[model samples]
Target: MSHTPATARHLLRRPDGDTTPRFSYGADYNPEQWPREVWDEDVRLMREAGVTVVSLGIFSWARLQLAEDVWDFGWLDEVMDLLHAGGIAVDLATATASPPPWLTTAHPEILPVTERGETLWPGARQHWRPTSPVFREYALRLVTTLAERYAEHPALAAWHVNNELGCHNLYDYSDDAARAFRLWLRSRYGTIDALNHAWGTAFWSQRYSGFEEILPPRLAASHPNPTQQLDFKRFSSDALKDHLRAERDLLRRITPDVPVTTNFMVMNEMRGMHYADWASEVDFVSNDHYVLPGPRSLDELSFSANLTGNIAGGRPWFLMEHSTSAVNWQPVNRPKRPGELARDSLLHVAHGADAVCFFQWRQSAAGAEKYHSAMVPHAGADSEVFRSVAGLGRVLRELEPAAGSGRAPARAAILFDWESWWAAEQDSHPSSRLNYKQEALDWYSAFLDLGVRADVVPLGTDLDRYDVVVAPVLHMVPQPLAKELTRWTENGGHLLTTYFSGIVDENDHAWLGGYPGPLRDLLGIRIEEFAPLLDGETAELDDGSTGTLWTDRITVTDTGTEVLASYRTGDRAGGPAVTRRAAGRGTATYVSTRLGPEGLCPLLARTLQAAGVPGDLPESVRGRVELTVRAGADAEFWFLVNRTDEPAELPGVTGEVLAGDAPERGEDGEAGPLVLPPRGVTVLRRAAARG
Candidate 1:
């Protein structure tokens, strides 16, 4: 495997010879809500809280334009000037998301209609139709105006275009949207006959003889087909991409140097927007993460943060939006425990974040997010949240120089594909209860448990660098990807895939042959039929352990494929539940059922051992201390995090960088493991060696 130099991969850097600031700490600030007299106080509070960057003008459209032709910037100008004077960098928003009432009122065509054909009222945001010419004209005007105004401002560090593009699903069935869909189809399918064939329009006497006859698939509940629904999902995603490209192009024209990005809500299954496509145009990725009140939330957020960081290929990204305490959107809004916020923030930075920012700086006086948590509550800066922010600020100020200058070294990678996600959910058969995110999480958890540093890489990534590549639930088998996987396996790279993978294509259309599609040859298994168990039913495995959820009946196609595990009961009792095949100099493993943690642990452990991954730590420090190593120039950095409540001991034979020691480790033959307090993270430097 060839290595890409560290210098070539680093996209963001501070001024030459300048010390990099520890990841920028800040939140979404809206001085627009307060008076000019309050600006100084806000700055003081921000400085006290160690807030260095402010995401400004996110929803300031109403203030930017007061009338159809009349523009207003009096308050905005003063706010920027004050923030700049305070030495706070600004992530200036283009304010294109929520247009002023006058524009929508003047042009009703800009308003989006729902799937039920009801047009949205003016008060709501993200209600504008993407295809409307009026919306395009006004959006461009707003972005260009803001870019030209602040293109050279010293305070502007980055450009944030439209807050959460495609917040609302592309639901328009109107004439304009239909026309645009037709044009997109024409460009993709080229001919009407190919479209008919791919969509399988002949099944319902619904063949489109021409492009004009084609319409976006709208399936009624009783007659829904997976193929049509899948196409609609693809079309909707493309439409949203078109909207983003328009805004991105305009921003690039004005300020090409400033990185432009939009925040993505991770685990959003309904949107169909994949990071693979969006990453092509984005400078770096940002994610809005909100954790529910449960043990699962912590792990879920970690998975998302790592996934986003990996999507950028280890480039520095930001925690674009998170609540300081409680989130108002859920059915039950719960606040984070005293140290949870700080712990999570460091965890993000340890993983890959270059900045830690929250959703809102101040509580909204009114609106849906009125009750959401903030740096300063509605009760003012004397609140507990404010104190926490201030304390965090002091810590950041002291540690920013050392921590900010370092990055993580990951040697493993997990393949993430959007087409597979779409294809899996769109399948007509199998349980509707099957969730893509949870499945991905299950596989990710396996790696996390073993303390393996794995980046959630996109499908087309160069696989030679990774010793093991895990693709869980790869439902769609794009031909190019199948070929790549085959090549990787032949070159001696271990590949692992799970059930319901390789079943469909890019269009969600099933492959002509049997299950597993093109992956069958590589997997060396031919599945005859799959048995999906109901909520309470169970399927037994060959080891006398029971497996629940679902199972598949399979036959080995090649002598190389070995059955690692099998079902223990039912009609297909003793059928293979897990199989492994040797291809060329490498091996491929295929699991025919979803295994719970108990069933999955041993399998994953064995795979890791075979791939030459690191050993398991002593059981005493398993969950308490998390370790990850990232390669750097001439050395490697090992990040040790204590997630438990009490100080814990560390393993011997490693360099120590405890709170007060010099940056060196005493070579003691059997030194006791160092003790780490609750929620603390330590970075230790060591030499890098190839496996």
Candidate 2:
């Protein structure tokens, strides 16, 4: 599949060529779980809640097709007509999320196998293997049937390819996956000799003479080859992507007018699919994010939304699923606070989400996710959860002007690479606790804390767009990437990277000579050995901050290198803890220890100042408020989200109040400071600057 810019997709439904901008609102409507009588009520509440669209028939495979020869559309047809009559559009699903019981029973070979060789059975969702031929045949049949039947339906707004592909069965070691993996390897390496050389198979006598001799990185004694594991991860992600393409192609061929999308899991630790690689395959990107309980929950949410918007190329994307309150799958599902429901939804809007939707319209009464929060909770529409849902709908309707706007580009960015993320945290590394995603998130939080807007962009994004780029734990430094970074630095882009980076090439082979290999000259520093600290160990720096987890013994090789901060206590005391070297008009800085969000603030403040990056908020509201801007041709919409539980005040702010309250005016007719409510989000519209 070729890349399609998300901006080109006709995302929303417009009646009679109406060009009015409006945010799409609703949830995944699972009418199959409820009786026909309840669906009418569901649509009524949806209208009251200002819903313009709903995703239907996502998990209705068994209900839609009871048997191989049987087909049931009477219920679906009535539901579709009901939604269209109720003034709602439908993002109709292909009903291929899971296979029916009949198909799985008939084709047992479609089941996925674990690395230890245990077969995954049907009761759960996504039980089939991505590389299964029989599964694709049956899945494509359902897609084709649905596409042909609803090609011209009035309510059909978009085609949802499949629900969260590779969410559960991403890594399959079955025979089907073995064959697909071999084929993918052949395509990637082109020859068996090339594969052997890349995998470094000569070390373990694991060299293969032919592609057929290879297998999925299944359970092995001691440890599997690092490069083999990395390749398998890549292949598994591609396998799922190929399945997505199959359904997408079929749907487009049958219903070429409608756009197609599948929800991506871009939340915490769900790095199975490289979404940067998958974004171009869909018309518009959609994501399912569930907040993980912690102090960093809000920051992580903002980080993920920022990354998702950039993944969509700054064009508006979809918030396919989130929670109305508490989610069912957590260790202890806690409900949202008084203002969190509306605040959370608006934050996504601030980050360029044109549509806001939840998992299901009504909560399920008899399923694994029965306890999960929905638009209409188990307490019915009269409860607080439903009231909050309706209130959010009104906010979305009021902020309709923000629908198709693009995110205002930031002067700084944090590079997020899926391949580097996969390879950096693999087994047999310096520290088992080295988390790549968390490190990136920490940098994002620091930016937010300092009131600096920094886009969390993918690895291959244009580096020339930003004045400063931060690449944390960028482990895999291929030749081309190394050259690009060097060129970017020479072209006056400040490059700041952390330890454990630039150590390995594309094949996971250590860059010879010394540590931080490919970037040694660019950074003007060298390290002969890594000094990864033990758990609970800490190293004190002269800058009054402490580092943990990892440290490096630095040896400056260039006369231009300046030590920004040095270690005050611990191993290699008085050595450089942070260093910077001038290259062309810009500088390359390096941090040799793990300094978390709070600890990173000081360094970031100084670095950003040197790079001439501007902060968005005033000093008093720096950490208390988060700022995100969405700009159209004429105006910019500023989203001032209060990150703290206490109310925050922003002085000297002037804009048209779009959502949330406006600043109070004095008797003399002068507007006072804009006061943000506790855990609230405020959207302000300002005129765009003209050159």
Candidate 3:
């Protein structure tokens, strides 16, 4: 319900007497990894690359604190001073991301325990448990030390909390976690009877007489209670959030002028924390996104960036970290092409990122990530990566006028809910192949394939702003949410949802009458059973497309309902595959099968037309270029990205070229058609246009 208290632009560093907002460009600087002489060269190359800021001392806990009684700040103080002298600001970290060898050696009880009752050792980062009192005491002590030391430092711009909270240690089942889970359950349910009713514990003699008897869903003989697993996921996220609050409060108390933030890993499968709930806790939102290699890689990148922008409430956010080239973690690390470095960064900026940064500044010669690319790679400044970085810095400087702008909302949106994602993927589901995020992403990819601009927003966002909304795999629908959707549909808003939606309430209890219980009346369809398909099997539709993963046996129950597509082959032959029902001036559509992004294009085109949602680009150039817009007070900045490896053209586009590949000039010196190079991006400052 709450919004960001401040914006990243207000806290970032800028030139002297320059009222124009500047976009920040830099990478994480780890001076501790190199010799003292190399530090000077690092600063020189940083200025050459036009870096404005760098996140310092993220994984330096072991070096900063040698023992319980010993502390060192001599080297860090010098680095801070040197960066300030070089006209670069520092995002000072708490240096508590990982526990030192001495701390873990002395307090092994703070280690995390797995669901199989195995203790996690301290070789890797994030070995400490979120619920451990001993871990909190030590971490907070380190945080307080950093805040007090850098409270008045001129180079201090913002406070960086623990790096990527809950990235590796999200699910802990230790004794401390058990105690914390009990307390969390008590707060949520308030009574033992209430907890019992909510968890539906009477099925396998799993009912508990008191809150003390409740434990986290550990490994058992059979699958754990579904609600119990869901609640534990919630509690685990909350536990990490509580730690973030603790560190943030200390920083705020010490340096009230500086903003506090922690980087969220919002990329693929990093769903341990509910970022929509965590957004309001910090002063501003920051995210670390990495490109995943697949058929829909670019779509996934845009989807994550769009979701991050919405999570920040359309305000400018910081891109904390991304890869310059191939990441070291993937099984087969392939180096990035020539133009991908700048294209990726500019794409994030188009989605409302004011600051662009990467994982590290220089390539490491002796670490786990040695092969990972950086601004200055192993070949040094003469390399192509460094040249691209320098060129991007110049481009960012030219686009200063577009800074601090908000993302222009689109006419269509895809509703994303974390609770549904967590609840739908349990062990005892009807099918193990059901992936909630992939289904939602398929719709997004379809939108992009049609050249339609759609925002991927959270569930609670105002639905009235968009004419069409698609909610995919919304399995768990509480009663209030059901009513909310119904009201929106009745008010002349087009609604589209898929199979496995509205099957259960907040307590994960199935609706007794039929499937899709709450939305049955609105969708005008009744499903008595679900038909899950096996792997390598697919059902054919009358539209000449095949569907995989799932299908629903439907019976039309309303007079206004019309079957748009039907199943041609399967157990339920000649049945309705897709149906639409009229509700007031709007329509409610239901899809009972899984159609991938390519297959959904034909149907989605019709849906877009019915809802009066038009694509931003011309039909001829659709699917070849991706269009994103950001609105300033007086003008709009349009970003046209070439999605393929070939040259693309756009005719009759008028604007002032701000950066990237520029369009040709007409005979009379007017703006002409825009020609985008292969894997290129062009930004144009145009007159105030439609959002």
Candidate 4:
């Protein structure tokens, strides 16, 4: 019998290999929430709804373990058997999402403690601290029990670890966490002297005498030590990862044939858990995403989906959880407009989602998430959401033809780092307005405007694949990583970095000699001082647009570099606001100001041209309608979406309609505009002609 590997390249695919369902649909199934009499009906409805896979027992820890040393698998066994009989597969959970109430009561210390020194009450779910040994022991016991019982169940398809690790208790400042933090620091920096130096603790006489003396950056007299905070974030992420690894090992030892995955909140990476670091541990990656409510909701979805797809190494991933309509958690839960359900789901597929599913199969009658939309809405199967759900199930089955195709390779790459995201805007900086994520999204949105499907990749990913790399706010740069980037640019990879990048090292200490220290040579400029503006202030630029938030007084050190754009009217006016240098065979463009999309978009366009990356300059790509194209060896699929309520038309486009049929191509393959209805999405697949 074949088994999942225990290392990096484990069962990245399903256990059954190519025979695994190409397109699967389902929801988080909680049979334990309902009576046994209802289980049979749930299974029947699942079959009718075309749910081939069900994620079972995600939050049933309390029910599954009854009492310490006493177990109850009878209900679960019945549920699994009933599901299999109804032709549904299982994404079985270890039931470790939350510890049983008895376990938590016995060890109240297992409940997470906030940085403010308040112990979290256990009324809600996932209350256990990530670093708590008591929590891990109980959680692992539950994991072992589940794995042993369902080692080779016919219904089992994948092993799901604890639900969204560190979602609630990502930052726990309890005694258990303090001990773990010291150990983590010892491993990262061997001696007390090294730790002191890295943290620059000598400032404010904060020098640590020993690792044990160090505590989490508790409400400091001033801003907490930046490096201490950074390391704490690092340690917090690692503690949760270590727990996942242990559970994964236990599953592989038992149900070695099944692939294992844990759902990720990849959109936010909430607690600084660099998912790029955790990507290799999971057999296959799964992500839970909800649309960010705003005018740019669709754009956010596309950006996040692309980011998740890239994090999966461009492999197809699972849409583990998305609300069928409005979600209960947001401040203003807006129900999805008609046609939005299918459009949003297909958007993920266009990017590279192999499976599409929602957070729940049935709506909860009571609970915190009772109001959240579901496939079987509270209104019943005849509701609009239910029809959309059933229609999507059929639509996904038809889209099975496109499953497993690789994400199209890109000519450009964007560096989106979790470390930079964490440390860049930490309390003490030139501007509290140095928004790391906004800068990234600006560059990414500009790329989408140019019809460029740039990979929003991690910093550590290999650079050889793309001709152009865009690093927006790469605030922290380690020497080794800088050297590698230097080599890539010298060997002919075009790079573009913005104002706040390359300023500090991992420890939040300035890079010594210059503002953008490690990257000074590549950029061919030295920034003498930071000149960030107030929120309302703006600096005029040569591009006819204005820069905001941050600016730098830059001086060109090398004669070979050229000035691309300069501040027209400011203290640093015409002092090389943006500079470019020919680094050997390639080029490096540096922007020394916060040039929003208005200023950065054109600069990005020029860089794309220099890098020889081809893309259309159509109105659809640049306007309210967003266009993305995915290509397979034999076909090209175009996803034309109208982001606004107004109808949009894509000029000179022609293809066979795969979804929404679009408005129309010209007569019989003649080129004409592709019409998109209000907030509509269309997929057009053009098959390559035979030789």
RMSD of 2: 1.6
Per-residue lDDT of 1-691 in model 4, one digit per residue for the tens? 4554533232233334545337788899877777778777787777778888888999998888889988888888988889888878889988787777898888898988877888888888888888878878888878888888887678888888999887887888999999999999999999999999999988898887888798987765678888889889889899989988989988888877788899888773363677888988887888888888765567778878888888888777888998899999888898999889888888888778888889899998889999999988899777889888888888787666566665776779888888989898788888887778778878877887776668888878889998999898898899998998899999999999998899888788898887799999988999878999987888888868788888898889999889987788878787778889999999999987777665677888888888888774365446566665566668866667766678777767677776775554356975456778887877777774343
- lDDT of each residue in 568-593, candidate 1, tens digit only: 77766867889989988778999877
**Candidate 1: TM-score?**
0.91
Order the candidates by lDDT, highest first — what do you get? 2, 3, 4, 1
Q: Count the backbone clashes (under 3 Å) in each candidate.
A: 5, 0, 0, 0
- lDDT (Cα) of model 4: 0.82
**Candidate 2's residue-wise lDDT over 1-691, tens digit each?**
3433335454754435454566899999999888778989988999988888999999999999999999999999999999999999999988888887898889999999999999999998988999999999999989989988988889988889889988899999999999999999989999999999899999979989899999988999978999999999999999999999999888778876678899999999999899999999988899999999999899999999999999999988999999988898888999999999898888888888999999878999998999998988888989998888889988888897777899999999999999999999999998898999999998999999999999999988998999999999999998889989999998999998998999999999999999799899999999999999999999999999899988899999999999999998998699999999999988999999889998899888988998888788899899889999999989999999999999899998779999998899899998999999999889999999665
Q: At residue 60, what lDDT does model 3 achieve?
A: 98
Better of 1 and 2 by lDDT: 2
> Where does candidate 2 stray beyond 4 Å?
1-9, 13-20
Where is model 3 more than 4 Å wrong at Cα? 1-20, 666-671
Q: lDDT for each of the candidates? A: 0.73, 0.91, 0.90, 0.82
lDDT of 3 at 244: 96
User: For residue 46, what is the lDDT in candidate 1?
Assistant: 85
Point out where model 1 deviates above 4 Å.
1-22, 219-225, 268-271, 398-411, 544-546, 616-619, 643-647, 653-672, 685-691
**Candidate 2 C-alpha error for residue 579, in Å:** 0.9
